[model samples]
Target: MKHCGKGVFLRPMSCDIKGVENLSVGDGTLIPKGCTFYCTRAELRIGKKVIFGPKPTIITGDHRIDIVGKHIIDVTDAEKLPDQDAPVVIEDGCWIGANVTILKGVTIGKGSVIAAGAVVTRSCDPYSIIGGIPAKLIKMRFTPEQIKEHEKILNER
Candidate 1:
């Protein structure tokens, strides 16, 4: 596996990371096998204590399917098209489940939990639990009072 900088942990038989640069991993992070983290033309800023389950695909590009009618082409031709790339940011302390697909331009907030096989299409809020095909906010990780307490602690640090 290709490492851009220090602090990235790759398990045995993990896929290589291409086009990634200027990356920093905090202490106690674990990236499992068969997971592909591609950061082409984008910066993937992951924080401390993040955990990635196996076979999680984090993609930073999506193709434009804006070809109007009558220009219909074969499936192979469509696959050769260039994708519009964007940055994918997963904040600190997120627990991403296995086989999860995180699409382009998505920012998963800190302390969020993403369930397995979920397809995240949009940004998720901090301390939220998300799951399903198109990932939805299932619940908050903390109560309002708990959140306030955490924020207070963070502010003091």
Candidate 2:
């Protein structure tokens, strides 16, 4: 593990992470090649046993889009529009597929599977199978009985 000032780069797999001080990753998380996380003004929390495929991008900030004809990059520091920034939370045991882009203020629930090339822009229930652009819920990972049992166990904790 290489520690660069305030940022801690976990060994074995490298990632491009902005605002590393606002990021926290759980143990046994496997971040494969070409994974990027951009966190600004908010904390990005990733839980344990999470697996990320190649070229997954998790961003927590979006530029404003109120000014007409003016590019977002050009309007810097001047009062134009408010930026949308929120924390991203990825719960434990998630299998995020290749080239998935997770946007701001999204909370991926535990034991969920996100399909390849999906764009996730919202929160999800636990054990969900999400896919496609904007990332709709395809199905639940567990059966009704299994979900009940899981919820029972979680309630005890």
Candidate 3:
């Protein structure tokens, strides 16, 4: 689906995007095929110049497994578990690799790289590189000097 100067390449088997009103994909963004974007009761805001690899899942729903597991005998309610419903914000200039799963209430900071197949459970810091199952910070995108220069330019603006 094309929207607002952005190109979204959605696969035929892509998961349904709920809460379309609350989801925003910015300009010059690309969402590859076979990805799942769930915007359930929370906003999903994607900034400009973002790229999503194939089969990526951005989920905005987290449940209490301990409480739900005990008394939720109903099979239907099992999948309908309650979530925190906080928004998932992916800021500008991000490259999200294939098969990544971003959980609820997480903010992926600007200019960061999320490696392929990483499961992001918490928030990420800007200009950082994250990988692995829980998404550890591997390194910063810029050196200290470069970061200072960048910040100086921003301060002037």
Candidate 4:
């Protein structure tokens, strides 16, 4: 919650955010209840006008596995075995459906639609319709010609 822009609505007592200062939400974004964002070691950025449905989890860090002789959970020294982390970016005008899990180092492209219950493990192209366990491109939201027209109309507004 470092840079919350105007008209953003983050419901109280519903969403969980660790490392609050490492996150930023852009203008007009609506984060519904039951969202969890962990930004312990990297930035988590959500661009303008983005909508996130309930129970969406965005993680920027993972448990340390490189520490020898101890399980990832059993590592006691924080300085010796730091968690691996990376930035997660969700670009403008995207729709992230409920129960979605967005992992570290993923940049969801502008205006993309992530289907519910999908696990986004990689980046997607702009305006794509993405779904499945390891989210894949189902289709583009519009044809190339339509996209041009849409962008023109949007710019005009």
TM-score-based ranking: 4, 2, 3, 1
* lDDT at residue 157 of model 1 (Cα atoms): 77
What's the candidate order when arranged by decreasing lDDT? Answer: 4, 2, 3, 1
Better model by lDDT, 3 or 4? 4
lDDT of 1 by residue, 1-157 (tens): 2222256576645675655563345556787888777765555666777898888888776544566653334323345345466678888789999999998789999989999999999999999999998999999999989989997897797
lDDT of 1 at 52: 89
Worst 10 residues of 1 by lDDT: 70-79
Provide the clash count, candidate 4: 0
Weakest lDDT window of 10 consecutive positions for candidate 4 = 75-84
CA lDDT of every candidate: 0.76, 0.82, 0.79, 0.90
Q: lDDT value for candidate 4?
A: 0.90
Error of 1 at 138 (Å): 0.6
Model 1 CA lDDT for position 138: 96
Each candidate structure's TM-score, on Cα atoms with residue i matched to residue i, is 0.76, 0.81, 0.77, 0.92
TM-score for candidate 3, please give it: 0.77
Better of 2 and 3 by TM-score: 2
lDDT of 1 at 154: 75
Q: Give per-residue CA lDDT, model 4, range 5-113, as digits (tens).
A: 9999998598888999999999999999899999867899999999988899999877766766878678643643343678999999999999999999899998999
Clashes of each: 0, 0, 0, 0
